[model samples]
Target: METRHLTYPDTPDAYPSVMVLGFFDGVHKGHQAVISHAKRVAAEHNLPVTVVTFDPHPKQVLSNKPDAVRYITPLSRKLKRIEALGVERCLVLTFTKELAGLSPQQFVDDYLIGAGAVHVTAGFDYSYGKFGEGTMETLPYHARDQFTTSIVTEQTRRGEKVSSTRIRKLLAEGQVDEAHELLGAPYVICGEVIHGDARGRTIGFPTANVLMDASYVMPRLGVYATRVKLQDGRTFYAMTNVGRRPTFYETGAVSVESHLFDFSEDLYGQVIEIEWIQFIRNERAFDGLDALVAQLKQDEVSARSILS
Candidate 1:
C-alpha cells in the first residue's frame, strides 16, 4: 500500500477514491468493520480503498495531558494492519491545532471533496470539525452532494462495544489474553535488545533487555508468558518481566527484559518482537537472589505449561 502524509491545505492526489476515516490506534475489530465496509464500497464503485488516519493522535493536540497519551498500535504498526486489510492507499493527516479548528464544512471540503473522495465510511459515532460538530447525520450536509457516506453501526462483542479504549484498559490491567481476543491477535511489543546490568546472567537466567517504542502503551508491570521473535526469524518461548528492578535498586525507570528458555545467544543491539501471552505474576522485591531465582523457576514452569 502507498502512504501519503499531508498537512492542512495540502490535498491528496485527485484520484477517485473510497475513504475510511478513523484514528484507528489499534485498528480493533470495530475499526476493521469500518474499513471492510469501505473496501466493499470501493469494490462496488471500482475505486481504490483509501484509509484516512491522523498522527500524534487528536487527543495529544486537544487534551491538556498530552504526555499521558499512549497507543495500542503505533503509526507504523497501524499502517501495516490497514495495508493487510487490503487498503490500497493510506493518507496520514498531521493533526494540528489549526486543522482541529476547522469547521465541519471546511473539513469536508478540504479532505473529502478536495481529495476527490467519491464515498466515505466511518463508525456511527465518528465526528469531524471543531468540537466534533460533524456527526454522521451532519456529514452529508457538509459534503454538499460531493460524496456519499456510510455509517457502520456499533460493533459489539460479548454485549459490549469493541473499542480501543476497552482494549487499552484490558492491557493496563494485565489482561493480555482478553485484549488479544478483541484485537484479533496477540498484543506485541517491537524493540531493540540493549545492554543491561547483566544481572539476569548472574542469576542463571540470561535476559535480553528491550528498549521499546515509547509511543506504545505499556502493559501492567508483571512477569508474563511471551513469544519472542528475533530479527533473524527465530522464535522462542520466553518469560518477560516489565518493571523496575526493585530487588536491586530502590527506584529506576521501568524496563522490559525477556528470558528465552533453552536459548543462548548474544542479542545486544538486535531488533526483536515479543508477543504477550499471559500475565504470570506481579513484580515484587525479593529478599535476595536466591528468592528471585526460585520465583523465576516457578514462573518458568507456569509459562512452559501455558505455552505447551
Candidate 2:
C-alpha cells in the first residue's frame, strides 16, 4: 500500500478511487466495519480504495489544554492496520490549526474532490471542518457533485457501541479481554528491554524490563496474561506486570516487566512487542520477597493455562 504524508496545501495526485475517512484510533471493530463497507463499495465501482486519516490528533491542536492524548494505535501502527485491510493508498494529513480553520466546503473541495474521492465513506458521527460543523449528514450536500458519501452506522458490542473511547475505558479498568473483543484483536504495545534491579532473577522468576513508549496508552496497573514477541520473532507466553513494584520501592515510575515461560536469554537492548491477552489480577504490595515469589508462581500457572 502507498502511504502519503501531507501538510496543508500539499495534496496527493487525483485518481478515481473510493475514500474512507476517520481518525481511526485503534481501528477497532467499528472502524473495521466502515472500511469493510468501503472495500465492497470500491469493488462494486471498480475503483481502488484510499484511506484518509490524520496525525498529531485534532484535539491536540484544537483543544486549549491539549491533553497528552495517548493513542490506542499510533501513526505507525495505524498505518499497518490500514494496509492489512487491503487499502490501495493512504493519506495521512498532518492536522494543524490552519487545516482546522477551513470551511466545510473548502475541506470537501480540497481533501475529498482534490484527492480523487469518487465516493467517500465515514462513520455516522464523523465530523470535519472548523468547529466540526460538517458531519456525515452534511457530507452529501457538501459533495458538490464531485463525489458521493456513505455513512456507516454505529457498531455495537453487547448493545454498547464499540469505540476507541470505550476500548480505552476497558483497558484503564483492566478489562483487556473485553477490549480485545471490541478491538477484534489483542491489545499490543512495544518496548525495548532494559536493565532493572534484577530482583526477579534472585527470586526464580527472571523478567525482562521493558521501557514502553509513552505515546501508547498504558493499561491499568496490574498483572496480565500476555504474549511477547522478541525482535527475532520468537514468541512466548508471559506473565506481565505493570506496576511500580511497591514492595521494593515506595515511590518510582510504573514499569512493565514480563516473565516469559520456558524461555531465558539476555534480552537487554532488544525490542519486544507485548500482546495483552487477559487481565490476570491487580498489582499489590507484597510483605516480602517470599510472598512475592509465591504469588509469582501462581501468576505463572494462571498465565500458562490462559495462554494455552
Candidate 3:
C-alpha cells in the first residue's frame, strides 16, 4: 500500500477514494469492521480503499498529560495492519496544534473533500475537528452533499464493545489471550535485542533483552508464554519476562527478556518480534539465583505445555 504523510493545506493527488477514518491504534476488530465497510463501499463505487489515520495520536497533542498516552499498535505496526486489510493507500496526518484548531467544516473540506474521498466510513463514535464537535451524525452536515458517509455501529464480542481501550486494559491486566481474540491476532511487540547485564546466562536461561518502542502499551509485568520471530523469519516458542529484576536488584528498570527454546545464537542488536500468548505468572523476587533458575525451568515446562 502507498503511504502519504500530510499536513494542513497539503493533500495527495486527487483520486476517487472510499476512506475509512480512525486513529486505529490497534486496528482492533471494531476498527476492522469500519474498514471492511469502507472496502465494500469502495468495491461498489469502483474506487480505491483508503485509510485516514493520524500520527502522534491526537491525544498526545491535545492532552494535558501527553506522555501518559500509549498505543496498542504504534504507527508503523498500525500501517502494516491497514495494508494487510487490503487498503490501497494510507494517508497519515501529522497531528499538530494548528491542525487541531480546524473547524468541523474545515476538516471535512480539507481532509475528506480535498483528498477526493467520494465516500467515508468510520465508527459510530468517531469525532473530528476542534473540540471534537464533528460526529458521525454531523458529518453529512459538514460534507454538504459532496460525498457519502457510513457509520459502522459499535462492534461487540461477548456482549461488550470491541475497542482499543478494552484491548489495552486487557493487556495491562495480562489477559493476552482475551486481547488476541479482540485483536483478531496475538498481541505483538517489536523491538531490537540489546545487551543486558548477562544475568540470565548465569542463571542457565540465556535471554535476549529487547528494547521495545515506548509508545506501545506493555503487558502487565509477568512471565509469559510467547512466540519470538527473528528478522530472518525464524520463529521459536519462548518464555518471556516483562519486569524489573527484583531477585538480583532491589530496584531496576523494567525489561523484556525472552529465552527461546532450544536456541543458541547471538541476537545482540537484531530486530525481533514477540507474540504474547499467555501470562504464565507474576514477576517476583526469588530467594537466590538457584531459585530463579528452578522457577524458570517450571515456566519453560508450563509454556511448552500451553504451546503444545
Model 2 weakest lDDT span, ten residues long? 59-68
lDDT of each: 0.92, 0.92, 0.92
User: Which pairs of residues have clashing backbones in candidate 1?
Assistant: none
TM-score-wise, the better of 1 and 2 is: 2
Which ten contiguous residues of candidate 3 have the minimum total lDDT? 7-16
Model 2, range 233-283, lDDT digits (tens) per residue? 889999999999988889999999999999879999998999999998999
lDDT of candidate model 3 versus the reference: 0.92
Q: What is the lDDT, from 0 to 100, of the residue 296 in candidate 3?
A: 92
Report the poorest 10 consecutive residues by lDDT, candidate 1.
7-16
Instruction: Give all TM-scores, in the order shown.
Output: 0.97, 0.98, 0.98
| Candidate 3 C-alpha lDDT tens digits along 1-308 | 99999987676677689988989989989998998888888889889998989999887888899999989898989999999999999999999998889999999888889889899889999999999999999999998998989899989999999998899999999999999999999999999999999988877899999999888899999999999999999999999999998988889888999999999999999999999999999999989777888999999999999888
**Model 1, 142-175: lDDT tens per residue?**
8889899889999999999999999999999999
